[model samples]
Every structure is written in C-alpha cells, then in structure tokens.
Target: MAALAWLLIPLFAAIGAGLWGSWANRNRKTAGDGIELAGYTRFREAMEKPDAVVEPEPHSGG
Candidate 1:
C-alpha cells in the first residue's frame, strides 16, 4: 500500500506536467520573421577539424 502511493507520485507529476504544457501552448502564435530572437551567435559544424594546418603556398620542385 505504501509502495503504491510512492509509485503514483510520478504518475501524478506527469499528469500535471502534461496539463501545464498543454495550457501553456494553447494560445501560442507562430512568428513569420526570418530571424531568431534568442540572440545566439555561436555556430559550429559537426566534427569540424579545428587543428588542421594550411599551407599558404605550394612547394615547387626545381
């Protein structure tokens, strides 16, 4: 009986969370602008080699 009460805590929490999320998004509107308002500027590609060395000029065999 006590163990069942403890197990139902998470179930009740999930129900509450779902209700809150639904209510929060009930009257939401989409933004059509092409810009993001989060102001995040850092951008990086996946698995890009940052330590690569570049040769400014090619060696010519004389």
Candidate 2:
C-alpha cells in the first residue's frame, strides 16, 4: 500500500545512514611520523636563515 511504501523510506534511510557512518569511522593506522617530522625540521631550518641583502636603488634625476 502507499502508506507501507512511505514507511519503508525512513527505514531504508536509517540503514543506509548507519552503514555509511560505520564505513566513514573505520580507522586505518598511520605508518609513522618520522618522515613528516623530518620534513618539518628541514622546513623550520630553512625558514630560520637570515634574509638576503637588498641593493639600494641608484638616485634618478627628476
């Protein structure tokens, strides 16, 4: 009947939402932070270097 079909819509939606939530939350472990930390250290070292000297512009006569 039309009422039965309408009732099924939410039931199906709840099942689908539960399955999607489980799939979305299933965790996979990260390999390690060694590589990422090393890269971050290099980035910090590069950023700490002194700024390069800028040459003064020659005076221009008006």
Candidate 3:
C-alpha cells in the first residue's frame, strides 16, 4: 500500500546511512600519542622565541 511504502522510507534511509558510515570510517586510524606529543613539543619551542622589535616613525611638524 501507499501508506506502507511511505512508512518504510525512513527505515531504508537509516539502513543506507549506517552502511555508508561504516564504509567511510572502515580504514580510519588515529596517529596516537607519539604524533600528539611531537606537536606539543613544536608548539612550546615556537612560543619561547623572542618577538621582533619595531622602531616608531618620527612625527613631522607642519
């Protein structure tokens, strides 16, 4: 019936979404602790560098 067909629309959508998500994430793996620690170390080293000094321009009186 038309009513049954409409009722199954969401069920089919949910099944399709689940299958797609599984396929999409099937090969994904995290870089884990070593990569994360390296990133933090690089960030700390960059922050310890001194900032550049800038000289102000002299004002000209009209």
lDDT of each: 0.73, 0.94, 0.91
Q: RMSD (Cα, Å) of candidate 1?
A: 10.8
lDDT of 2: 0.94
lDDT of 1 at 40: 28
lDDT of 1 at 51: 63
- lDDT at position 24, candidate 2: 92
Residues 4-53 of candidate 3 have per-residue lDDT tens digits of 99989999999999999999989868778998899999999889888766
Candidate order by TM-score, decreasing, is 2, 1, 3
Give me the candidate number with maximum TM-score: 2
Using lDDT as the measure, the top candidate is: 2
Q: What is the TM-score (0 to 1) of candidate 1?
A: 0.43
Reference-based TM-score of each model: 0.43, 0.59, 0.42
Write the number of the candidate with greater TM-score, choosing between 1 and 2: 2
For every candidate, C-alpha RMSD to the true structure in Å: 10.8, 3.5, 4.8
TM-score of 2: 0.59
Q: How many steric overlaps are in each model, in order?
A: 0, 0, 0
User: Model 2 segments beyond 4 Å from truth?
Assistant: 44-62
Predicted candidate 1 versus true structure: per-residue lDDT over 1-62, tens digit per residue? 99999999999999999999999889767674434533323233323538667767876868
The window of 10 residues in a row where model 1 has the poorest summed lDDT is: 37-46
Task: Name the better of 2 and 3 by TM-score.
Answer: 2
Model 1 residue 59 distance off true place after TM-score fit, in angstroms: 83
